[model samples]
Target: MNDEASELKPSPKIDPRLLELLVCPLTKAQLEYDAVAQELISRTAGLAYAIINGVPIMLPDEARDINAVTVAQP
Candidate 1:
């Protein structure tokens, strides 16, 4: 495959151990991995943290509010 085509491929799955260790920074609750969306869902916190290039972006400011409600500032 060409470089461009290769670049379009999905990122490798995140380490299971790392996922087990991760928690929602806001709620300190367990996270659910959504591989299809490349996000870590925090149902308690109503947020979805994006996983970029196999790395989870845990920053609340960078997270997307899955519930459509405002994420309070820290």
Candidate 2:
């Protein structure tokens, strides 16, 4: 496949309702979606849960520390 075709391939999309339903496992706080990173960020918990193949892996052990993530400023 051509590079353009590969770039155009659709990525798995998470359901909006599911995003609303999920929370930070450690803090019980609401999560913010980092669509570009495919992660659910929990500022309160200082962790980011990964979204794989449209499924959210909410396990704390599977999460990356939010402090380690560098978000670009708009």
Candidate 3:
């Protein structure tokens, strides 16, 4: 690893390219970025994927659930 690599802090923004490639690991569905919550949400599957310090928490146990109202909508 380079010196700069170690010094790099986690980014708040998810790269457009990276986002395009990212999927909800549980369902393999598309993920929506919630900048305010810093989470990658999968409405289809009712899972809210968290992004801590810019790195995504892909673990199922780490994810939160969406509300009933939010999930009810098409």
Give the alpha carbon lDDT tens digit for every residue of 1-74 in model 3.
69898678445798788889989888999999998788999887888988988788978788898864544666
Residue 1 lDDT, candidate 1, scale 0-100: 56
What would the TM-scores of all predictions be?
0.82, 0.79, 0.72
Clashes of each: 0, 0, 0
True lDDT of residue 29, candidate 2: 98
TM-score of structure candidate 1: 0.82
The top-ranked prediction according to TM-score is 1
Candidate 1 lDDT tens digits, 1-74: 59999978877798999999999999999999999899999999989999998889999999998988666999
Q: Report the error of model 3 at residue 25, Å.
A: 0.9
Model 3 ranges with Cα > 4 A deviation: 1-11, 68-74
Worst ten in a row by lDDT for model 2: 6-15
Global Cα lDDT for candidate 1: 0.94
Pick the winner on TM-score between candidates 1 and 2: 1
1 versus 3: better lDDT goes to: 1
